[model samples]
Target chain A: MTLATPPVGEPRHRRGSPRGTGAFDRSRRRLYLPFVVPALVLYLAFVIGPTLAALWISFHRWDGVSDMRWNGLDNYSALFDDPTFRTALANTLIILVVAGAAIFAISFVLTMIVREMRGRSFIRSVLFFPHIVSAIVLSIVWGFIFEHNGTVNTILSTVFGTEPIPWLNADNLFLMILIGTVWISTGLYVTIILAAVDRIPRYFYEEALLAGANAYQRLRFVTLPLSWDVISVAAIFWTISSLKIFEFIYAFGGTTNDMPPPAVWNSALFVYGESFGGRSPSYLFGYASASAILMLVLFTALIVVLRRLLRRDSIEF
Target chain B: MQMRYRRRRVRAAALTLTVTLGLFGAACSADDSGGGSAQQFTYWSMWQEKEPQAKVLAKALADFEKESGIKVKVEWQGRDNVTKLLAALRTDDVPDLIDQQYFTVSNAIVKNDQFKDLSDVHDMEIPGESKTVRQVIPEKYDQFTTTANGAQFLIPYEVIGYSIWYDAKTLPDVADNPPKTWQEFADVLARSKASGRNPIALDGDIAGYAEFWTATALSRTLGPGGFYKLVSDKQASGWNNPGVRNALAAIASLAKQKYFIPGYDSSKFPAIQTKWAQNQADFLYMGSWAPTETGTLAAPGFKYRSFNFPTFGSDESLPASVIGFAVPKSADHAEAAQKFIAHFLHKERLSKISSEANNLTPRSDVEVPEQLEDVNELLQEKKLSKITDGVLGDFSDFDKKVFQPLNLQLMTGKITPDEFIDQITTGQRDFWAGHRS
Candidate 1:
């Protein structure tokens, strides 16, 4: 007992020897480079390469047929002056902030209600079915349901004796699109958050319940705290996916076989409307590329800010 | 454990085998087209295989091949044929013959100087007829056939244009004496509204269709080629032109009167037009294709007829859209393609465009389809102008970005005529400034 001894708390192998600089560690490290280099090369070639190319192309004026001419910042500067582009940018942000807020709120409520419900799996599947269907199909069906003479109006007329409403008109079109985005996207986030919530030990909820915590208090303390990481990831996921939502809104043109009006267009549609779309193709590759670059930069910054704001220390159950 | 390993191996092997076979099949089916042969020319048609136009063309092509001892390989590409053709232009396997709306070909192929000079094509005699290609097609269509470079880039075939359509059975007075002036047309609309019927059926969702009110007005106020000058003015001074204000007033007056059917702005395309075809509305300003498109949906005994846009000036500039063929500058078998154009231009062959396809042919001698007779007569009676003053072909983006939105507001009663002018001027100035470099 009196004899000097190595500290019991200390790891024996790490006492004098380097932790990760050993011959075996060095060899294992060498294996990672070979394993990752191929994937790195592919990612750089396809993703990074195109991103740089788009940036480069954004500075020039090109119709995609003739040689590109340099017009530094003109394409980007022109975007602000463009009313359609402004509307598109505004619509995109509204979808991101407004629709996103709605989707998360509804998803959480659904998850909380479904958590203790009977036949939860079947209910979850029913909620998730719209997410699995094609956006084009969903948009078409949604449009038909809210059309002037469609289901909602028909019901209102017969039941309440209300006059038909113009749901798909210009003033209301963007609002309908926002509502649609929420309806279509909520289920996915619900499934994800529910999965994350399910991972928490059941004992935590039982403990909260035993402590005289109400349902809301239990969700606020036990459920939400545990699901923060997934919720954050889902928020970031929605930010990215929402920007790429084209088919749903594009299909809402509703048999006109034309792009929807500029008033309702989002950034995704802005890119398409400026190039390779409509009966008369614009082919404004440079301008469209510029808009694409702006969208990318703005969203990338948003994701970074979002990540910082949502960061939390992982809690051990 | 050995059995499990064997089963896993079998599964992996099956997947590998299936992937290999899939890759092979994809490679085999990649492309079947070959380089042009000595006496064969390839054609990429804009008609779908099952369409009436394609049927007529198929029969004509077969007969041409039998007669000339030259084969024509055709791909039945649909409406997006020009888009496909443009992509193929970069490759070695370019189609020898291509066809599309004249303005479409003008904007894409002709604008880029990719079309062969077809001024000689006009003089080329039809295969079994004494008349030349130019002789068969009306001289008036010559306005849209040539490019700015003075090259006859397109050979006119099908002629389409905007007209004020109506059911003759419902509106006998309109059918008997079609309105020839803007005042008279407005009177007709007022009268129709008073009789407890909606006057006009507009698919307000279609900007082009909605813009008809303004475009026709401009065509009337600004005489021949005035609309083009108004649109293409680099200084953006065209909006100040009195004619622009005049055109705006016409549409503004219509919107103010609520002459359009209720909920017209929100009603989807084909819905409003189909209702008009079913005689729910008295009039619809649409293209010549209106009748053929709505023939099935039309109420029984619906006599489809149309009148030219009512005049505001002495010179009546009627809108005409030509759908035709063009040979690419780099075509492999240009001679055969040119020869086929001549053979197909024959009266007998061209007549099928009207008889079978329910379309108007540039050859006035061809018997007019029942639905298209009124428009054909109007084209002959009025001074023909390129549809939308050919501005859609040259400044399509400007129209979409700057003009169409403002035009929509003007037609929808969202903005006053003066507000539209002011806003359009600012929009045009901004647009050109960005594009000037």
Candidate 2:
């Protein structure tokens, strides 16, 4: 009927065509690759392009208002010796290790509880609500809370009779920032992990149960392996985000207004303060650009390493 | 299950807001009274505050609208006042009148050449207000109003002063008065600490609060004009200068003194308002602006007064850094704006501003509001109410460059006075060289 279907072993498409489909397959190409160009353009313009420009600017010094001077790694050289920069780097690492670990572990446990819930959607929204609010707005709100005579201390003094702690001190500045960040962002991860947990079929659990596998055994064998890919992706995201932690810290603590947030100046706040924290020198925006470049490098390295550890064979379940 | 699930997405938020169209409609009543020249001029104020000062100004505008037959439509944009003026400068359609930050007068001149020199206008105005303008403003503020090219930028709007604000109730039974000298001041604070009260309730997050106390105190010690030269000169930015080092060391010594309220740098500025409100701390060295409602300093039963900050070095030569406002050159309704400027300085309007929350008016015609104790005392000096550091005139970019960094260094204990002066000089030299090119 169709010339015997081009024989059993014959190709369905031309050699160069994907899935053996020809280039003339207009409708199929239109349906599939329509999304590709837009996504590519978005990634190029916003992500890849700005990154390269930031890298270029990092070598020079320019205040946002003035002309640029190509310092040729002078900013980088200065950054290495700069106490503020060192503090920021250490702070970023501490946040990544602490918040990253906590967010993931908590998300897993919460997902386990939430997955078996009756009001699953309601619980999911509650967890994810903070993620919808902008970090800057949230930080401002938190600032009111942690402010010297804020509500937190008012309650503490009234209820437990504790004195107000130096919540925004150099010693605990990063900790307050971390606590705020964790509260706002962990919900998104929990939701992601929950979705992954949902996709694992009940059949696997039933089969495991018949095999006399307990809840812990069923979870380890069925849930953990199935959700490993999603959990790994979440970790990679948290790593990148932790490296560029700016809005919360920047809004939470101002260098002029607040003690430079325990000198744990994430590179974002570091460059920002250098550019315009009231005492900025002649607009060496070039140097700010340079710090941005270095941050990109650091973030890229983190992503690469995480990919190596979390990288795995695409599961065939 | 499906019905229950569907209801979650369709639910309304908790707070139910009534539209109240009737109330809103009543609030939008139009005024049509006219007495004189029906000049419909547009005006703008930088502050969108709900304070009575704004309301009084609005009433005056309405009165002016009734008297002059000039309906002033004001578009108020609220945010950082100076930043808004800078944005207003880059456009052609600007309001006829503007109320902007006092420091912006310099940039206003450089950005646009459209401003009608108020001095020229001052000379042209009727003889009645001229004497008032001349008498109220000191020579220093006159210098500030003059442009780089030497023209009056704008009339004085408001004057601010800063000093140590103390809870009068918390004064120990032993100490009779606020300290007059740096050592006495330190001792008084130590006494306060010994008495189980925070000696200083400075903000935790701001470096400026600390800098203000130490700098003002040091200026009192360092011959009257010493700190003024530091602000105007460029070489003093390095932490190497002796005075710069002295200032930082002084502040650092205070920081280490343990008499400062705990969490000094981490506490937000307004939170200090509460600390003082709750009588948790004794002294707050803040702006004269604090007496205003905008500072939110006045809580119910709020009792406080200002004293001259205890001095380390005397500075008779420089005035306290005061903030004011000016309309920029790109103003659309320049004549109406001029009228508004004049209105702001008029005796009744100025008095209203001064009386409301006890704000200071630079107009010599008006007496100091009774609520402000410091200015009332300073008014007694009558040694020409000198404006802040640039009252004589604004400095070039280089001049600002020279001192800004040194000021930071001085605050941080990172540099000495000699180094600070040297940096100022170097910064000035660099700025001068750049200008020459």
Candidate 3:
């Protein structure tokens, strides 16, 4: 009787057809090539073309202005041997894995709590606010909160009589940045997971409860399974976004004309520091390009591996 | 029915493509229409549009336009001028005149042989002045004028001298009698610390700013000539120089005494500077630009003052550099650019630059603003030293790799004086080895 049932008496293809389904399908198939050509041309011209160009440039020694000289593999070898690049790579990975894990775990906890709260919508809106704000503005606010003579220090001195903490020191800067990253990213994941969790029927939770399943058990047996697909997609998204984090760290220089100290540099900062950065730019185009390509390759591999690991069959209600 | 639907869909797609292609073509044609008349000359200034220098230069350019009956298109590109210039040099859209810091041009762009010879501008009359451009500027700036190939590449305009700045309202005694000896300076710092205050407020976020303390100490201890020799000489044992050790030890002692303000190593740029302006800190080591740079954030009645870093029984030579204009080799209007430079150097225009821009004009005859009287006096005294004592002058890489990192560690008390020197010398030796190979 339903539209999906395709009426009981008609053949499968013709049942739903108001205007000759077979002929319409054939015509649509004929239109696909012409319809797709423009988009494919654009994609090739903008995305794939520049990517291949970057790969070609990565093999040369160029200052961006002068003639490019071919020096195959030398840039790659130099990158691995460079201590600054190593630090940048390590920082980027730490941001990707460590900050990412914290974001997911915290977001999951927040989702669980917000799901049962009376003012759930209000809480979700508040949590989502930081994500929508500019990263540069967020970084500036974060800096002021943690500065020595800033608000936190003022509160500590007056209320607790505690000495000020050096929250943004070289030893502590990357850690502070990681914590800020977690704060900013948790909201988006929470919203995503909440949306996935909301799709589950109320009867599923009621049945779990009647069967003597506790809240944690229900989360494991009901909520998590239903949301697994969305969680996997979110994981891949986080992996890519975390690698491109530059503005949040770059703004820490706070009116400085030069790039931030190398201690907190990520791959993006590394690429910039090598070319068209600093008071006097080094402009090592080939070196910067090689680093960029390395990041692309690493991110591509990570995304693929993540998809494989987080893959799950959809659960139908 | 199928044929009608197919025809409609194909028409819609064709319409969308046509619209997109039309928009793109419009954009391309709009960009292509930017070429101006042949009588126009373009200038790209390195100052932001709102900066005092940019305003003064715009007015001078306007005056030149009126006098010469030539149209000049000025672009305020700020710090992006260097990058844009490099890119534009490869194309026909290159600017006729580009303003840049002398050190930046000499260090980054000069070796590329892109700048035209500016020797003719040296003898050009300074508009209505009886003096030629060369006669007004001191011979000391000649160091920046001539490129490695012995061709003049820059016309020095706005000069900057670096020194230790302090809030006069807070430290009237130190301001009255700025310490002239290292021992005296240390005593002042010790006294300031003993009175429950930090002596120095450093924005250690900028490693180069932190390096100033060590550079000044080395300059004083080794003298300018000795400091240059130590930096330029390729000897593996450059760090073994007694002056280098003494300078590091002196910086370490300040750290040992906890003379820097709390969280000095971790504080962001302008935060420490802001605190210094607020009279919360005793002294700040910065360039002459500090006053104008921090003017908006300074507390009420804040009197900004500066003095040369105290010496160790040697002549004081404060760090100095010049920011100026140069014509590119491919410029189509080199004569117009030269005329602009000559007009810019006129005594009347230079005086306005000094007064309105809060800049130290290179011309000795122009009177500096009251805020920069101290810097002008030092310049008149001929006490300005090359930046970093001219150390790392020939080796620009050493500033980023060797000097800044080592200086930051030293400032943070993360590394000892001995460790600082060892790391620097090792870095220098490795750098030379790589270059030689």
Candidate 4:
């Protein structure tokens, strides 16, 4: 029952070590800084530089074209009072938590069922297909399914004798979007969990069965623990990706070329709507930036907490 | 080994710093070279290249190039030209001419002072016509040309009037005898429903479409100035105006009676418009562009005609908007851009825009396409009014907070008439309070 554990806190390279004397290790060390510095420079210029600029912009009043005026904390204070920003913030959290939980739970169940099936590869591929399709296309198709007099309504009326539902109305739109996000995201998580599950040694499951453990017990003791690290990583991925969901929701506005109703807007949509969206772009760059920076700070804190909650001692194999 | 590793790290850091500095240097020096003998200008158009307006503009540009010996580079940036034009204004590279809807220019770009004053163009004679630019374009279209600061910033190129459209084939009798009063309109809807036809097809997915009904109703009930008081004046009592409640209630009753096509609330955009074109509904309230925008989706031989939105007692103005073009302040070839504008507005050229493009040209002398003959009649009769003119320049916030949300709720039957008024009044008060500080 012994699990192989790699040294957690040990440095890869120690001065005068026997391993460091190897030619490959020495050459790899020599090339490491050269290879990493290029990408690091780009990352700083494009990602970090703009982020810092946004932070600076958040403290000023700007319309993208006008000379920026220092507004101190006024923009930040205004965001708290903005009803649209509050709705966007609430929507972002719901997608991150509710949609994330649904995606992982569904993926895990599907992965468990498909692992031992005869056509497991086909089923896995079929489930994984949505991950590759552009989210805008998926959103359009999803809208059609739930649209009044759409596929869902037609089926309900002819087969079940039920009335059509207002699936895309203001009160119900965000809920429908949450469900659509879960449906689109589950496949990718299932594929990742399945890969992790496949890596677990077959002998561990066999031993669990030999000890008279039931199917659920085997999954609980062996499979779950073995895939814990991957699951935690997936959780972090979902958090970051969920905060950036824009195109799918933006498409929901249809041919109108206007921003979606504030009730359904997430933080990303809020940034655009405030700054450069709407039929006539608002150009409230400072206000938009304040909300954006606030969301980033909140998201960063959530990610750190998630990592701590999901942390566990890793088994090498 | 430690010394060698430190030396390698230092070398890598130096190399990376040098490369980064070199990249910045290259970016700084990348400027357009400037010695062309030929007269050249760059134009960014808001219309897609294949759209009828763009096609006619392209023909006009070609004619201008041939006659004037100007090499014009045209970029079809489509609906995003306003944002692109704004960005371009901040940089050295800019388009000599940009086309945008009049509302966008007045409310977004011109408000920000991005466009050059084109008042001189108003006095310039058309290239091949006897009239000056201002003489050919009717005075009603002047609302779109003038900015908040009283400067003429853009030229109105197309005339767009908002009204109720009906397919002659679907409701032949109604098309011939359009509703002219609130009660008549209501009775028409009821009769249409009783005859097994959906009275209206609304693209409710976009809240703007739903807001149109409220805007028209309010303008009719309150008169244009009173409607402006309700939306733009930011006075809380504007919402308390009995006319405001009645207008909202009128629209709400349509939803209450299910006069709109079933499932309109959940229908995808253009889907409801397509349904209207297919004659699934007997009527659609839309802009003058409705015929052209939905023409392809129309049932075969579906002839479309539009009439002014029927008035409530004492209200008679038809809601109108305009689409047009402008030159940016940063333009390098402003003179050439003006020349191009004058050429495009020539009587023959405008006639082509009307005939070939199936659009309502702003020039009063140009004969409109047969499809828009009804709309032209309204214009000729001087029955048009700016539907949302009251809030046009400074109502973006109120639009988002009050108009858009409550309109959707009212149309979807989520709120009563009283609740709608209460929410809007409270919302407007809070919005103004926040801005006042």
Query: Fnat of the models, one by one?
Result: 0.33, 0.23, 0.31, 0.39
Candidate with better DockQ, 1 vs 2 = 1
DockQ of each candidate relative to the true complex? 0.29, 0.18, 0.34, 0.40
TM-scores, one per candidate: 0.90, 0.72, 0.91, 0.93
**For candidate 1, lDDT tens digit of each residue in A169-221?**
77788888889888888889899999999998888888888998998898898
lDDT by residue for model 2 (A258-315), tens: 3243255677776665553332122345656766777778888878988998875444
**Best DockQ among the predictions, by candidate number:** 4
Q: What tens digits encode model 4's per-residue C-alpha lDDT throughout B96-157?
A: 88877777766656766877899899899987778799898777777667865678888888
Any residue pairs clashing in model 1, and if so which? none
**Alpha-carbon deviation at B397 in model 3, angstroms:** 5.3
lDDT per residue, candidate 4, A219-289, as tens digits? 88898899999999999999999999998888864444788888888999989987778876677788889
Which candidate leads the pack in TM-score? Answer: 4
TM-score of chain A of each: 0.89, 0.82, 0.89, 0.92
On residues B271-309, what C-alpha lDDT tens digit does candidate 1 reach at each position? 788889988888898878999899999999999989988
lDDT of 4 at B391: 59
What TM-score would chain B receive for each of the candidates shown? Answer: 0.92, 0.72, 0.91, 0.92
TM-score for candidate 3, residues paired by index: 0.91
* Model with the higher TM-score, candidate 1 or 2: 1
- Give the C-alpha miss distance for residue B417 in model 1, angstroms: 1.1
Alpha carbon lDDT at B209, candidate 2: 52
For model 2, how does the per-residue alpha-carbon lDDT over B160-267 read when each residue is reduced to its tens digit?
Answer: 666666655455332256566667777877877887888777665664455455455445545444556655443435335566566556665665566667656567
